[model samples]
Target: MIGAYTIGKKAVTFGYKRYGIPGAVASGGAALAGYLIVRRALKRSTNADATGVESAIDAGEVKSAVEERGLGAVTESETLERAIDEEDVGSALDMNDVQSAAESETDAMTEGSEGDSSDER
Candidate 1:
C-alpha cells in the first residue's frame, strides 16, 4: 500500500512539473494568433481609408486640371460630370464630385502606368 502511494505521488509531481511549460506555450500561441488577426484587420482598414482619400484627391485634381486646360484635355470626362449630377446639390462647385473625379483620375493613371510597364516587358 505504501509503495503504491509513493508511485502515485511521484506521478502527480511529474505531471505538475510538465503542465506549466505546455500551459505557457499554449497561452503564448493564442496571444500571438489574436495579435496577428488584429494587426491584419487594422492594416486592411487603413488601406481602405487611404484609397478613399486618394479618390477624393483625384476628383479635385481632375476638376482643377480640366478648368485650367479645358474640357478637351479630359478623356471620358462624362463620368465626372455624372457624379456631379448625381449629387445634385450645386452646379458649379460640388466637393463630392471633385473627390470622385480625383479618384477616377488616379485609377486611370495607375492603370495606364501598369499597362506601359507590361508593354515594355
Candidate 2:
C-alpha cells in the first residue's frame, strides 16, 4: 500500500513534466487502480483468514509469537497472517506422519492387487 501510494504520488506529481495533463491523468488513474487492486487483494486475504480455512488457526489459538509479543498491540481480529516465521496454518501439517500413512496405504494396495492378479491367473 505504501508502495502504491508512493507510485501514485510520483505519477500525479511529476507525470505532467513528461507527458502533460493527459499523461498525468492517465498515470494517476493507473496508479489509483493499482492501489485499489492491492487494497482489495489485502482485504480478501484478511477476510479469507478471518472467516475460516481448513485446519487454519482458530481465534482462540494464540501463536507463540503472539504470546511473545504480549498481545499489547494485537487487534481484536488481525487474521493472524501465516507468514514463513509464524507457523500459523502450516504447523498443523506434520509431513512425516502423513508420509508414513501414505506409504502404509500404498503397501496395502500393492498386496491386495498382487493377490487378486494371482487368483485371476
Candidate 3:
C-alpha cells in the first residue's frame, strides 16, 4: 500500500510539473483548430450564392422592367412591387399597436405587484 501510494504521489507530482498541463493545452488548441477547419469547410460548401441576393435582383430584372415602362415609370414590376409592399407593410406599425402593447405590459406589472402585496399582507 505504501509503495502504491508513493508511486501515485510521484506520478501526480511529475504529471502536474511536466506533462499534464502542457498536454491539456495542446489538446485544447488542436480541438479549436479542428472546429475552425470544419466550420470553414461547411461555410464554403454552402456558399453557392455567396451574395445572397435574389436571382431577379442579380439579373437586373427590376431595372429591365423599369426601363420597359419608360424613364418616368412610377409602376414597379410585380416582383419589385411585392417586395416593396412587403417592406412597407412590415415597417408600418401604427401608434395603436404600440399603445396596446404598452398597456398590456403595464397591466401585467400591476397585477404581479398586487399579488405580491397581498402575499406580504
Candidate 4:
C-alpha cells in the first residue's frame, strides 16, 4: 500500500511539471504580443499629432511673414474680384471669409508682439 501511494504522488507531481512549462511559455508569448500592439498604437498616435502640430506652426509662420511683408494686401472689393476670377464658382471660401481670417490672424500677431515688447520693459 505504501508503495502504491508513493507511485501516485510521483505521477501527480510529474503531470504538473509537464504542463507548467507550456503554460509559462504561452503566458510570456501573450504578454509580448500585447506589448507590441500597444507600442505600435502609441507610436502611430504620436506621429499623427506631431504632423498636425508641425503643419499648424508652418501655416502660422507663413501668415505672419505675409503680414510683415504686406504681400497681397488687397481691398475687399479687389479680393472678391480676384477670387471670382481665379477660383471656381463653387469654391468654399468667399472674399469676406478670407478677409476676416486675415484680419484675425493679424490681430493675433500684433497682440503677441505687443506682449513681448511689454515683457522687455
**TM-score per candidate, in order?**
0.26, 0.34, 0.26, 0.32
Question: Is candidate 1 or 2 superior in lDDT?
Answer: 2
- Global lDDT of each model? 0.36, 0.39, 0.33, 0.35
Clashing pairs for model 4 are none
If the candidates were sorted by their lDDT against the true structure, best first, what order would they fall in?
2, 1, 4, 3
Q: After TM-score superposition, what is the CA distance of residue 16 in candidate 4 from its true location, in Å? A: 85
Task: Quote the lDDT for 89 in model 3.
Answer: 31
Cα displacement (Å) at residue 107, model 2: 48
Per-residue CA lDDT of model 2 for 41-109, tens digit only, reads 333333335222222432222222233343221222232333111233333434333334334443454
**Backbone clashes (count) for model 4:** 0
- Report lDDT (Cα) of residue 8, candidate 3: 31
lDDT of 1 by residue, 6-108 (tens): 3333334443566775544443333332222222222232333432323322233333333334332233334334322222222234434444444455455
Specify the poorest-scoring 10-residue window by lDDT in model 3: 50-59
The digit string of per-residue lDDT tens for model 4 on 1-121 reads 1122333334334435656755434333333222222222222323334323222222222222223333223223343233222222222434455455445544555577689999999
Relative to the true structure, candidate 1 reaches a TM of 0.26
Model 4: per-residue Cα lDDT at residue 82: 33
